[model samples]
Target chain A: MSKQHESVNIIEVKDVAFSFGAEKVLHDISFDIHRGDYLGIIGPNGSGKTTLLKIMLGLLRPESGTIKLFGKDLKNFREWSKIGYVPQKATNFDAHFPATVHEVVLMGRYGSRGLLHRITGHDHNLVRKSLEQVGMQEYQHRLIGDLSGGQQQRVFIARALAGQPEVIFLDEPTTGIDEKTQGEFYALLKKLNEDLNLTLVLVSHDIAMVTKEVMHIACIDRTLVCHMSPEEYLKESHSEKIFGHDVKVMTHHRHKK
Target chain B: MNFLSLFQYGFIVRGLEAGMIVAIIAPLIGIFLVLRRYSLIADTLAHVSLAGIAIGLLLGVNPALSALGTTVIASLGMERLRTSKRVYGESALALFLSGSLALAIVLLSLAKGFNTNLFNYLFGSIVTVTSADVRIIAGLGVVVIVLLVAFFKELVYVTFDEDAAKVSGIPTRLINTLLIVFAAVTVSLSIPIVGVLLIAALIVIPVVTALQLRKSFLATIVYAEFFSLFSVIAGIFASFYLNLSTGGTIVLIMLAIFGAVMASRKG
Candidate 1:
């Protein structure tokens, strides 16, 4: 949780704006991320954390401004090998999809394999290696739907890792997971950061957990209010500024528990 | 005996061949239909296409061609309805089904001659099918099936999660429209071989049977194909040997297979 890596400038967002019809979601938001930056994006519900991540990944078109990854526009750098995404706890998946964990993970390789290319031995090895990395090698043949929420989250991370992307975007990757699993998940991500130097940008409402996990934090609420280290963002004064007056009562200094 | 002679004489070869191809493709499309929760879309399109064919009779054009055109138009409407956010896909399909059937009834009443041609369209026959029909069925079957296999991964992804598919950079919207288009056209053309009432059975039965035994996506497709082939062949020969209706017999065979699979799965 230290501000260690500072020179890479891997992602650059300039004056980004987004809206659904007439109502705006992100307003003139801007930010920059460098290599090995595990940036945590946090905000209250409906704060456009997911939308901002989607725009960064080129999944959603911004109403204005530009987003660049590794000096190239995001839309232009969609070599699946260069990017990874773990959508917010894939709860929307149909339980009867009939695909095994191995098969689901293999789909991550499809973008890198290009159109009409079959899953090759290299892709299979990478998928297996990703599963092993997530400690899910044992569940490789099991139906994805049969897994627990935490196990399923690991599977999704494995899927993202299978792409071998430099930067991975995880949309609230720890939702509905137990506290023990959440701690292990954070440790796993930290290991990825230290060992492989994988860049991570995650969205979540778990401020305390994210402060313990991510190094840099973008505390968002309909705008790119400020970018700071998690500790600074967690300061008593900053928390009030970010969450407004009502947040003071949330941490009431009640003498009795 | 008279109907048996049609198959025994080989003069009815084209219709029999056409029936064989449609029987296979209907179930292939049906697998995705059921997965996407759009299984009823097929039934609706089949009924709508019937009205289109009836209109064709009133205009003296080929009923098959009109059915294809009208189904395409109806499919476009279904897509628009699905996109409207307020109207669910199932309700849209039902609306089109009811609307088309009513139009067809009125149109059929105005046609010059109705009984035999309409009966053949409704119940299907080996006697009235032409070489052109067989050729169309074969070409469309090959193209649709091949396209499906070629885009197998994308199809599977979309069938399970449309939003995920779109976010992953797959052309989910285009693929969605294309699927309904493919379904509508295939249903329109296939109904001439399988009656509209039983087309749903042909589409649903094979996949249901395959799903009982197969867990993987690819295996399900292959097993569905196998199930379809079995039902069609058994239905054809049974209908030929016993002098029964080909369309009805084929659907009954599929339904029997479905029932057996359900019973086995339950037990």
Candidate 2:
């Protein structure tokens, strides 16, 4: 990585916490993600990963602490053109809802265009290019509900890419796809990081594949455990720290694999 | 009567103009209303809006003014009922519908001499409509259509994927409030033609008919607008020939169109 890329922080989350009604989901958490860093967030279920992402994106306000994006306060980042998001597979949307793939991809531009403006020629060009990114070019005019699972996921990624976002946060983008496609999905995300220099935050439970795919890994169980490089994460001591008593079982399982 | 006869005939032209304007926007709003599973809300809110018009009559004001004002309030209440976490939106619609009507009845019976022409607000008197009503409905229709065009993509996005819209930084709450207020304005205009009990048919029938053929959002809006525009005109003329109530005939035609379209889609 370039010295500037390594030094410049893209996301600075400080002492963040959140709760639904009264039940607190996340305790005090703090972390910093550098520009072009592909960071993976891993945790067991109900570990508040999704909530933390929502808080970072300004969809949910933390009970305490602050979030800063690109050196400015998160709330001040009104430029949606800078960020892309792929929510979990379940939220891929109601397939029965009427929209062509091209129209669906065009929605990424809606945030930047606001209410008064219509899609222009430039917007259409970007949509076409984005569809090509995820190999959905031929399905541009097809209804979204007609696509298979992997194709739908690709369509969603293309929709996010249409915004030309500098940073992408995907909440479990590989779910439900077969093992082979899941590997391919990771390769695509990695390509995005290297080609477009996009900063990424991925939340997933699959530790085995994530360490190979991402540059940085964070252990989150309702708090920021630590963030480290893939090499650091592979160390036995770090594995002991992350998995604790389960580390023996994990190592034995890895042996079987 | 000559070519200028309708304009020369005054009330005939006024009623036609008013019916046309209502027919345009009600079904346009109905597209999202049906999509978001809010069809029942529109139907129930029409009844609640009627209750608001009754309260206006009981208070001895121009029923439209008070009706418009109270219906706006009632529309907000409907949105709140839908959003409140403890309340299931469907059941809340039923509760609000019945509750608002009961309140209207209490206020109406308490007022002196309400049982007479007061019922005209329930099952509109289209022939009794005046030129002023025509102007208001037309003006409101223009505003509604303008907003719809300007906010088409945003509105569609919000209706289709509310969580996505919110996460993407769209002002979804404001858009939702605008929809409810739009529905209230639509209901107020429609009551003059179809009455409260049946006005929802004006909104639902055309959109439902259009849904059978439309495979895209853009097409859905076009077909919905066309269906309503022509249906209103046909219903008005049909009533004139049959010597019947304009709103009832319009809705019957709309339902028949829906039934025919459904059968065709099946066949």
Candidate 3:
């Protein structure tokens, strides 16, 4: 809302480092995410990709360095409604969990209204619009657990979208879903980013899929290996250092396309 | 005796009042505990409430109020212990459960012996329900219900997924701790009808039964309340006629309901 915020980067990470006990997961990682950027963070299983995402979301604090959201210190950033996060896809939720898709999506409005405040008509419209965005408006009355994995993931994303955030962080959103469903999910993300002007940061293990979809790519291993346009990343062949040489074989096919 | 005549006794009236309140709140809190996979915390806090009652007996204080105070603190402590890296989750509860029982034993011994009054708490004597006990249960039950209603969305969101709740800036730690506290308060308030030994049943059985039905969350809540209230009221009636233990009878009724529901679902 401020003139200064309009000129500021969506996220700024500087020299951030994190460790788990004796094992150092991230070392001196730095990157800036601008408005309207669809950035994909790709790495191997133990490569600290999720940890880095958690740090950026302020869920886990890095051992060293500073991170800012909306040009304010991550610790001091109070306007959480501006950011939405969809956690890992293996929800482990109860099969009989009593909540409907509509109820789950309405949760996104909670941060704005907070405790004791009722969800207003605007919030309901946002929930409906979010479900519509995910092409899940018809399934609003369905139990979340009753839906297929892909449908459930869409509902989860709709829950995040109902917040009406400027930026959304998704952690391995397509895992466990089938390949064809993954394509549709990516197309949905693309629409959300381009049409809604929503900044998107996604963590995924599928290098070929990520490289083709995201406008920018941040390849992270123990640290950030490269932050560049997808075209440059596909050409430079630096992905091997992050995802290993197998990634070169994967991206090589993409580069020819 | 007819059903109308059962209301003549003041103690039975108080018993119904307290049982009704516990019936609604116990399973209400239990549903969340079950969802969070913290169902065992209810059992552990119930044991801790027994210790509170023992300490209250030794100190000549109101056992229900003392149990209420003690279990609230223990519940907060359990929340901290639940995250202890050194102890496994169930093992942590085991420690509290056994430790609280041990404390109750020591307090019971210190008081010289378990008097008839003290014995009433261990197995529940709704036939001897005091006006003071009813007042406390009513007041505490209302507070717990109010808190649950006010934060229903946040509680459900957190129970469904804690990490997502935290990143959404929902004050997840506070809600998590508050939920445990509510469980503690529910256990303490329930002792008059269910007793410490059977209080966990009051909290868990209704919700487990409701889970059998394919219902929405709000419908599940309403259904659980209905089942719990039926068990409490019917158990009291059965106990009065058969001269059986009130707490044991109530839990037995609920267990029978749970078994029937599970069987019907399987069939």
Q: Identify the leading candidate in terms of TM-score.
A: 3
Off by over 4 Å in 3: A1-8, A238-244, A248-257, B84-86
After superposition, candidate 2 runs with Cα above 4 Å error: A1-6, A234-257, B1-12, B80-88, B91-95, B112-119
Residue pairs with colliding backbones in model 2 are none
- Candidate 1 chain B: worst-modelled 10 consecutive residues by lDDT: B3-12
lDDT of 2 by residue, A34-143 (tens): 88889998766667887888898887899999999888897777776788888785664776677788888888888877778788999999999998887789999888
Tens-digit per-residue lDDT, B167-266, candidate 1: 4667777788888888987887787667666677778778878877647777777888888988887777777778888789888888788888888878
TM-score versus the correct structure, for each prediction: 0.88, 0.89, 0.95
lDDT of 1 by residue, A1-257 (tens): 34464567889999999999899898978889889889999776678988899888777799999988889887676554677888876555776677789988887776677556676799999999999999999999888878898888888888889878888888888877778988999999998887999999988877768878888989778898768897677774454777674444433321111
Writing each residue's lDDT as its tens digit, candidate 2 over B6-87 gives 4565666777888888887887889888888788877777877767777777788766666677778888987887777578
* Best candidate (score: DockQ): 3
lDDT of 3 by residue, A148-250 (tens): 9899999989989998899999998887787799899999999999899899999987788998999888988898988887787777766354555577554
Instruction: Return the candidate ranking by TM-score, descending.
Output: 3, 2, 1
Clashing pairs in 3: A98-B217
CA lDDT, every model vs. true structure: 0.79, 0.79, 0.87
Individual DockQ of the candidates?
0.38, 0.43, 0.60
Which has the greatest lDDT? Answer: 3
Better by TM-score, candidate 2 or 1: 2
Residue A167 of candidate 2: its Cα lDDT? 89
